[model samples]
Target: MTIAWASFTPWLALSGGVLIGLSATLLWLGMGRIAGISGIAGSLFSLKAASGDRAWRWLFLIGLIAGAFIVHLLTGGLFEVRSGYPIWLLVGGALLVGIGTRMGSGCTSGHGVCGLARLSMRGLVATLTFMGTAFVTVFVIRHLLGFGGSA
Candidate 1:
């Protein structure tokens, strides 16, 4: 494998990472809630949840979408996201991710970032499992199945 140095934007990546961390930190400090996408989204589907309980979750999701739009506006369509997978494949992948997050109790933002920051053992284990699974899956798909470049 070769590095695509021309396409790499370390500064932008670093800034995004910093922003994510800061947002997670602020959410924890201000709201005392984990920045877990699954948990936040799932709460809205619960019939037992009060309207007040659902408000923040709705806002958080809305903010996420709005933030992407704001970024697109600010950058003048600079960010280009490309995918070779068909719509069915993309949908399937999303479904798998949702299942995985449900099974794992939290998503990457929760376990990998906030959980680890709090030094929770479960977070460490979850993060390891997530990373290991990703590594193995990528290796199998790319090398074993010979589906590297086409993807």
Candidate 2:
């Protein structure tokens, strides 16, 4: 039950959380849209999406990548490429996440942040389900199977 003290960065984590919250709030207030990455990305290429809608989605997605790149550049490569996982496992996990997001109707940003902010019951259920599943998965991987270490 030891904390990963060396990896802990509370202030940076808090700043990131605040930035996420602020960005989500701004997107909601300015455009009346939930800042859900899955929803934005999923519908980006849909035939039913309007040209304007697609434009914004593209810009949003670009901004996300650009933001991370800018931070990496500014920090002189503070971020590192993750290693140690098989390509098959990574792809499988990504596929599962995509499927889960579709089944859940939203992601953490939508359900946990915006939905909860609006006091929606569905959001609470979705967030709880997501957290519960994550907890069990991590426990099983790290304790039971003993394969999750800094990966």
- Quick one: RMSD of model 1? 2.1
TM-score of each: 0.86, 0.90
* Candidate 2 per-residue C-alpha lDDT over 1-151 given as tens digits, one digit per residue, 9 for 90 to 100: 7889998999999999999999998898999989998888888745788887898888989999999899988989866678887776678878998989877888999899888989999999999999999899888877888774743
Q: Name the regions of candidate 1 deviating beyond 4 angstroms.
A: 146-151
Candidate 1 collision pairs: none
Residues 115-149, model 1: lDDT tens digits: 89899999999999989988998888768876645
TM-score result, candidate 1: 0.86
lDDT of 2 at 8: 94
